[model samples]
Target: NAGIAATMPALDYPLAHWQLTMAVNVTAPFLIAQHTLRAMRRKQWGRIVNVASISGVRAGTGRLGYGTSKAALIALTRQFAIEAAEWGVTVNAIAPGPVDTPLIRGMHGGSTAGTYASMLPMRRYGTTAEIAHAVSFLASEQAGYITGHSLAVDGGFLASGLLVRDLFEPAASAPS
Candidate 1:
């Protein structure tokens, strides 16, 4: 389940907003895993991938609730992975940056979307297919050795820590 950020200052977070975001982003995943793991344990094979967000790894402008909830989800993924490994179940999270999903487009329209893209090291928003590929890999038999990992499919957004334009823009001429 996707989460909705209240986009407010930490101190301004409404109780309802925090509750709702946690309900969808964190609690839902925990509940799903609780039920699903039973069958996975029985079969001795399973893969569960939670869709977290870059906000979970790093704070943004104003995502107190959203970020917190996603962070919780990541922790949950790790905890489940450790326990489920012996049963042949893998639990991991894919933290996507700015994917070109309808939800993202709606959240960041027109120029705002472009601005967000420029901030990424790739200077472009990630495609849903890219995120899916990561999920597909983690779910495959080849990834059996991997568990309790949060794979970021963010086009280097998490690594760069600086904008593409700032990294590549031509230097201004110094006074002669």
Candidate 2:
């Protein structure tokens, strides 16, 4: 998925950026759609599910460039959806939070070292299968009514900004 790279935009040598991320995140899919939709014009049906990231919805510290890129990618999804709708090619994005993937390993050494693994209500990293399930459903015939939507598969992490611990009542101690 090219993760962070896929979400950001381009700048000059002044920016010191990665083209793979920008192209995969923004341009390549658009071009693919351009070509595929051309073929699907008469056929009048297709689906484009862009794998966006949680960065698109909320920015974290020290991720300005990457986060900004994803925000742009979300906009691109909407724009493409508008253009492709008449052709029956519904364009949408899936913004996943911290899923357990090798990309995180590359960025943060190990899964334990990654951000918010223990903090999550699930107390574990999201599995690839979980994300794949969402994508599979998105690709199915049942998801025809859905488009221009950015679904979050982040294990309910984003729903609550603050974590509230459940406290237990003190058990009675025998007289010592």
Count of steric clashes across candidates, in order: 0, 5
Query: Which candidate leads in TM-score?
Result: 1
Q: 111-154 in candidate 2: lDDT tens per residue? A: 34433566565666678999888888887778887888888888
For residue 28, model 2's alpha carbon misses the true position, in angstroms, by: 2.0
Instruction: Tell me the spans in candidate 2 whose CA falls farther than 4 Å from its real position.
Output: 4-14, 18-20, 110-115, 162-176
lDDT of each: 0.86, 0.68
- Superposed on all Cα atoms, the candidates' RMSDs to the truth, in angstroms, are 4.2, 8.1
Relative to the unseen true structure, what is the Cα RMSD of model 1? 4.2
User: Residue-wise lDDT of candidate 1 within 83-164, one digit each (tens)?
Assistant: 9999999999999988998887897876778776877879998998898899999999999999999998998888976432
lDDT of 1: 0.86
Question: What TM-score, computed on C-alpha atoms, does each candidate reach?
Answer: 0.89, 0.77
Clashing pairs in 2: 5-21, 6-21, 6-25, 7-69, 8-69
